[model samples]
Target: MSKAIARRGIMLVLSSPSGAGKTTIASRLLEDPGIELSISHTTRPKRKGEKDGKDYHFVDRETFTRLRDQDAFLEWAVVFDNYYGTTRKPVEEALAAGRDVLFDVDWQGARKLRESAKDDVVAVFILPPSAAALEQRLRTRAEDSDDVVKRRMRGASNEIQHWEEYDYVVVNTDIDQSVASVRAILAAERLRRTRLSGLKGFVQTLLATL
Candidate 1:
C-alpha cells in the first residue's frame, strides 16, 4: 500500500458584512470533505435559525473578556459594535489532525488570524457587486430595523476598502459563480507542493524504479 502524505491543514478565512453573502458561501464550503467550520464565540444575540454552538457560541461580555485576557483567541474582532472571537485551540487541533478550518469573520479578526497562523492561513474577502446591492441585501434579511440597515451599510464601505489586505477578493455578482471561485481557490491551495509532506520519499521510490 502507498504511504499517505502528512500535511498541516489550511485555515481558510472568509469575511464580509452582516448580509454580504458570507453565510451562504461558508455553509457551502463546510460541506467539503477536508474542511471544518470554526464556530465563533460571540456576545451578540442568537438569530432565529442559529443554535448555541452551531451558529455562534453566545456568551456574556464578561466571558468574552475573560477569554481574551487568557489569550484564548487566535483572532477576535468587534464589528457593528458586537464582540466576536475565534479560539486558538479548535483551529490548532483541526490542523494537527490534517483537517482545514473555515473562518467567517471581519477584517479585524482576519488580521489577527494571519498574525497567529501566517503559514497555514488563506484569507479571502467577499465583496458585493455594488453598494446599492449590498444595502438591498441587508434590508432583505428582514430582521434588522431601518436604522440597523443604515448602520450596516456604513460599516460595509469601510470593510470593502480593506480588500487588498486579503490574499483573494471575490466579487459576489452571482452566487454559484462566486462559490465556484472559492472552491477553485481551496482546491489549488490543497495541492501546493509544500502541503505534500511525503514528497521526498515518494520521489526517491520512483527514482529507484529507474
Candidate 2:
C-alpha cells in the first residue's frame, strides 16, 4: 500500500503594478483546488458590492490597531492611510494542513510577509512588455479618467523599480503565456524539499519495508 506524504503549504506572493495583469494571473491560478487566496484584514471601508469576508475582512481601526499590538498579524502595512494585514492564525492552520495560500500584495507588503515567514514565501514580480504597452493596457480598460491613468502609470514606474527583489520576474506580453509561466512556477515550488515535512518519515518507512 502507498501512503501520502504530508507537506507544508507555500505562501505564493504575486506583486505587480497596475495594468500588469497580476490579478488576472492570480485568478487563473486559483482554479486549482490546492491553492486559495490569502484574504486580508483591512481597516479600509468596504466598497460598493464588496462583501465582508469575500473581498476583505473589514474591521474598525481600533480593532486593527489592537491586533497589530498583539502581534496577531503575520504581516501588516499602512497603505494610503489604511491598515492592511494578514492574520497569522488562519494562514498557519492552512499551511499545516498542506493547503497553499496566494497573496496579491504591493512591494512593501511582500517585504513584510517575507520578513515574517521567509521559509514559506515565494515572491513573483510581474511586468509589462514596455511602458507604452502598460499605458495602452490601462487605457483599454476605459474605467479610469485621464488623470487617474497618468497617476497609475507613474505609480507603475515606482513599483517596477522593486522588481529585482522578487524571486521570479515575468514580463506579461501575453496573458495566457504569463498565466502558464506562473502556474509552472507554482507547480515547481510545491515540490520543493523544504516544504515536504513528511518526506523524511516516508523515506524511513520505505527503507524499513525494503
Candidate 3:
C-alpha cells in the first residue's frame, strides 16, 4: 500500500463585522484537532477568564510596537484603542508540519495576509442576514454601550465593502449551517493538488512501476 502524500496546511482567515458571529464560527471550527487557532498578540488588557498565550498573547504597547517594527507579524491591525497582530513564526511552523491555522481578524488584517501569502491563504467573509439583525445581536450581547454599538453599525458598512476581497462568503443566518459550510471549504482546500507537496513524487513512482 502507498503511503499518504504530505501536504502543506492552509491559513484559513475568517473576517466579519462585529456582531456577525465570525468568532462563534471560529470557536466551533477550533473543536477539530486538524485545525488550530492562531493566537494573536494584543496590547489590550486581558479580560476575565482569558489566559495569556491562549486567548491572546497580551503584551504592552511598547513590546507590541517593537515586534511590529521587526516585521515579525504576518498581519497586524489596530482595533478600538489596542493593537492586534498575528505572529509569523508559529504560523510558518504549523504549515510546515501540515497543521492548518485559523485566523479571526478584521478585513484589514485579512488583506495583509492575502498580500503576503496569497497561495496559502483562504479567506472567508461572514455576513449577517440583515442590518437590523446585526444591530440586535450586538445589543443583545450587552457588552458594549449604546454609543459603541452605534459606532460599530456605522463601521460595518465599510467592513462589508471588503467582502469581495475574500475567496468565500457565507451569510451567517444559522450557526450550525455556517460552521458546516466552513468545514466543507477546509476539506476541499486540503485536497487541492497544489498543496500536496509529495504528490508529484508519488505519481512519478507509480508511473515508473507501470
Candidate 4:
C-alpha cells in the first residue's frame, strides 16, 4: 500500500474595509473542518457576549506592548485607536501540525503575514458592491455611532486601494455566493504543488516500483 503524501498547512487571510462582510464570510468559513481561525490578541474592550480566547485574546495595553516587544506577533496593527495582533506561537504550531489557519485582519496585517510567510500565505480581499451599499450595510448594523460610521466611510476608499495586493478578490454582494467563492479559493490553494511537502518523495517511490 502507498503511503499518503503529507502537505503543509496554509495561512488563509481575509481582509476588507469596515462593513464589507469579511467578518461574516470568515465566520461561515470556520465551519469547515480543514481550517481553524487564528485567535487574535487585542487591546479593544470585549463586547457583550464575547468570550476571552474565543472572539479575541483581550489584553491590556501593557500586556500587548510586552508581547509586541518580544516579537511574539506574526502581524500587528493599530486600528481605530486600538491595537490588534495575531500571535506567532499558536499560528506557527497550527501550521506545523498541518492545520490551516484563517486570519481575519486588515490589509496591513495581511501584508505583514505575506512578508513573514510568503509560501504559506493566501490572501483574499473582499469588496462591497458600491459606496451606497457599503454605507447602507454600516447603517443597518446599528452597532456604531453616526460619527463613527461616517469616519469609516471616509476610510473605505483608502482600504479599497489595496485590493490589488491580494491573491484573490471577492465582491460581497451576496453572502452565500461570497462564501462559496472563498471556499473555492481555499480548496485550490490547498492543492498547489509547492504546498504538497511530500510529493517529491511519493513520486520517487512510485517510479521505483514501476
lDDT of 4 by residue, 34-124 (tens): 7999999999999787899999999999999999999999899999899999989988888887789999999889999988898899999
Output the worst ten-in-a-row residue range by lDDT, candidate 4. 1-10
Native-to-model Cα distance after best TM-score fit, residue 26 in candidate 4, in Å: 0.6
Please report, as a residue range, the 10-residue window in candidate 2 with the lowest summed lDDT: 1-10
Candidate that would win on lDDT: 3
Candidate 2's displacement at residue 7, Å, is 0.6
Per-residue lDDT tens digits for candidate 2, residues 105-152, read: 889889999999999999999999999999999999887789979988
lDDT of 3 by residue, 96-177 (tens): 9989999999998999998888999999999999999999999998888999999999989999999999999999999999
Best by TM-score: 4
Candidate 4, residue 44: CA error in Å? Answer: 0.9
Candidate 3, superposed: residue stretches over 4 Å from native: 1-3
User: If the candidates were sorted by their lDDT against the true structure, best first, what order would they fall in?
Assistant: 3, 4, 2, 1
lDDT of each: 0.88, 0.91, 0.94, 0.93
Question: Which residue pairs of candidate 2 clash?
Answer: none
CA-only RMSD, every prediction: 1.7, 2.1, 1.5, 1.6
